[model samples]
Target: MTDTSEMDRRAELSEFLRNRRARLKPEQAGIQPFGGRRRVPGLRREELAYLAGMSVDYYIRLEQGKVRNVSEPILEALTRALSLSEDERAYLRNLVKPSHRRPVSRPKVLPGLLRLLDMAEGVPAYVVGHRADVLAWNGLASAVFTDFAALSPRDRNWARMIFLNRSVQAVFADWTSKGRDTVAYLRVQAASHPGDAELAALVGELSVKSDHFRTWWAAHHVRDHARGRKRFIHPLVGEMTLDFECLRPADGGDQTLVVYTAEAGAASERALRLLANWGADAATGAEAGEPEVGRL
Candidate 1:
């Protein structure tokens, strides 16, 4: 198989292992806990198989994606056996469908939009398509999290940053919720763009690299975060809780601009002002053209 196809397989295997392992509890499995013999927190493979009423061999094969044609009832059994969340159960079903896909296009980044993003200055602004691919982000956006322009193309994945990058992980103080939202957004995106090869690849890569990604992906949670409160710990800005908004075009169904800003008179707003001054000074030093600067 090619690299792209391999990514899909990897994602499938990765997510399966995570979900299967998350459902186990000695008490839940009706086993008496020997004071110190329980090394694993979740259920073992055989235990899970027994609960699902499937042969251990069959379950293992399914988990491995060696058996691809799983029925809905079987999936439901796995969901119940593993105690999967409603979102995860939905995700398991999505993974089996042929139409579910990711992006594979060379992104067409717009100069005007980049300029607008730059203009946002202190306020973080960036655009992502249906697949949650960061098409463009301003310097402040980069300052708050990533500098997309400076990063290698292969490494510009949002999910990877959440699960793989230390800096990104540190930004979200609410890790579990952060994880939930990430899956929710992607689940929604995957549904919106079922044939996007690039997105599929991103999902695939995450599934291969992180078991958490795998489990979450399988759960198939869906959400649209048009407006919400998000907290971030910027190395320069310190702790900040910003309100976020999603702007979508009337003509384009998938494109959205995400803007982050602190509420008026809030401590985070004050911190943002301080960070802005620092950012201006740094921008001056770089001889980089200035983007727009504004208050929250």
Candidate 2:
């Protein structure tokens, strides 16, 4: 089964090229008024190839999965011709980087570290790792995110929440792009830590269970999710666009601390205050791993 590595590579090459082609259009590239009966949105194979100053045959071969190895110069030409976004361009380069997919190992979080999640005051905070495991979160985070506390340790997958959770699906205003980024980020994580068995299992589950994840993963996209504006439609709080920052400790390349905050005086701020009050008033039950007030 794994012997189909070459096929996989070729399929990725074919798929990305097709997607890029489908995304571009004839009129945008300044083609004259010969626009009747066009079957696609973006530039066609030969047309795009011609615009990139490459032979139509060569581009056709790439698109048809006939070309195995592509040079950097030609790749750059294709990148520009396709008008790739920063993320798309980076993903393109990563796919060509000769390496196998690996999983990042999950780290052991000391109790103190997990407790830090609860110290963010008004801001929502949570800790995740390379595999998108929910390492830890404070009450505000639990309030901001869907019932994260309810998920089994093994079932806590950010990607899964994005797709499976109806609440999470409604969270991102631009759900499609957010969904794509989640998949792409997983691809990058899978690549960097191929040895992580847990990550492998996660990918396996997603690839088999979700056709949408399967489609995106096969495209071989990669992304570095450092910071961004996240729109969350919390069940308790209507819609909140929060500025999120990912903090990686000096000793922590794999572990990421994601904190969320709203612009001062925004409706999101009011929603978060309401969430915090709900969280404070809501009895905090002791989880399996964490220490308790009486026990130790």
Candidate 3:
């Protein structure tokens, strides 16, 4: 009897492979099309098998997740044949052979890291650990993004905020793109942390809740968060464009300290300055147990 987890993993593998294969057209792969009514969008099973230099039966079984112990060479062949991105390739490997090690139960927020966020008070900064949990955040981050301190620990996840919180969605100028990226990152996290029941539950909950999440999750897109320019329409500060960087702290147990900065002398810089002052003032005036200004 196949375990439920294993069956779920196999189903994910099959869907991911099929989606990747379906996106590459025959012309894109330099293959000449010979003929009958094309049923699917992209390369057929036999064509992909030919490109990967494997027998059709073997490739079909692999797609069906029936072939266990897939070799390195075979995986490499599939990577090339599908032209998977580095992130996508990593995701594929994880799906084929998931990690068995348990993740840190609760990632600690080091005092030094919190101090660093305090020191850089002018810009918005936050630390996100596994599963996009906003483990630690500065005042400016709450001002620019959301008041993470108010949310329960589980609801502090960026994935949850972006998908479930309508107010958070309104802040991002490119919310659709943001949602897609969040879904893709979560897809990578899901494959990488197969042992994480909380992570799995988060995905399941979002899939049931968000329409966009369900559609994008099925697309199988994968990417790592890096430096990017993002536009935000803050309720207090109005619109501002900021360049953000995701920095992984050494020995911080996979915690990424994300900082957002605007180009000097720009309107965004001025807006950030005003936002920082407002955030500081809000913090000073808040009564004990009072909720912060940015609820979502």
Candidate 4:
């Protein structure tokens, strides 16, 4: 790596450790508070070092990103001391020892995958690539989310839409929660793709334009969009709740197939049906009859 990139990596790693440490309370870590006024919100460096069973100087060096080739046992100790979640632990691993990142290239959704999306008739389904790019979408997905087909290629990112698009912001019932999740997902992607200029530019743009994005990015949170429930206040269909599942391909690529489903006999199901009908009508009017798929 270039010196500049190495410095950037070290800085990121340091900030991540600091934020994680700052969120952990001394009491929560079973540390007894001592006699002075505590200046920080969370556990002090010495307390953390004590919990991790390491020397204060060694822990300080690790926290400062000065330690190289951090051992597995040391990492495990820190993981326990910080009480990191599964996703957070994975992110910690990436930061301390990031893998060799491949070149960034536009990911293409396979024709077979497009067909799979089409077959998911009653549900909203889409494919998202490494940078949260909307690589492909089924009709219901376009209806539930914004019309991915209508967006400019660059505007088809979930993070961009969540942070920058007013209509999208209004659609999610809990916009802030959704926004934070988007930010966390982006952080995870950044750790994996440190050399991706487009990804970095996207983060920089969102950080500039959205206060929520800026704050959440600085928090150093990391998450995987594996499965979750989302509430939507869609314009046409008043309100609905849906459960989403993110399925990754066996090859372990960044492409994820996300599908959203509503309860079988719930009001949300009815709303989805209405949205599907509306989407079909909209589809008929378009000169391009097929749903826009694999447009990366």
Residue-level lDDT of model 2, residues 56-90, one tens digit each, is 88888878777656788887898888887676675
Clashing pairs for predicted structure model 3, backbone only: none
> lDDT for each of the candidates?
0.67, 0.71, 0.82, 0.82
Give me the overall lDDT of model 1: 0.67
Residue 273, candidate 1: alpha-carbon lDDT: 75
Clashes of each: 18, 7, 0, 0
- TM-score between model 4 and native: 0.92
- In candidate 4, what are the lDDT values of residues 165-275, reduced to their tens digit? 999889899998999999999999888877777888899999899888998999898998799999999988799999999888777777888899999999999999988
lDDT digits (tens) for residues 91-209 of candidate 1: 56656544443444645545455555556767877877666666666556666775555555456556767888777788886877887788788875664455666777788888998
List the candidates' TM-scores in order: 0.60, 0.71, 0.90, 0.92
| Whole-model lDDT, model 3 | 0.82
Deviation (Å) of 42 in candidate 1: 22
lDDT of 3 by residue, 79-173 (tens): 99999998988889988888776877667766566566657768888777778888777678888887776777778889999999999999999
Give the worst 10-residue stretch by lDDT in candidate 3: 283-292
The reply for model 3, stretches above 4 Å from the true place, is: 110-112, 250-252, 281-296
The numbered model that scores best in TM-score is 4
Task: Using TM-score as the measure, name the better of candidate 3 and candidate 4.
Answer: 4
Poorest 10 consecutive residues by lDDT, candidate 2? 287-296
- Error (Å) of candidate 1 at residue 9 is 15
Q: In candidate 2, which residue pairs get closer than 3 Å at backbone N, Cα or C atoms, i.e. clash?
A: 24-42, 25-42, 102-193, 102-194, 103-193, 103-194, 104-193
| Candidates sorted by TM-score, best first | 4, 3, 2, 1
Give the CA lDDT, 0 to 100, for residue 186 in model 3: 87
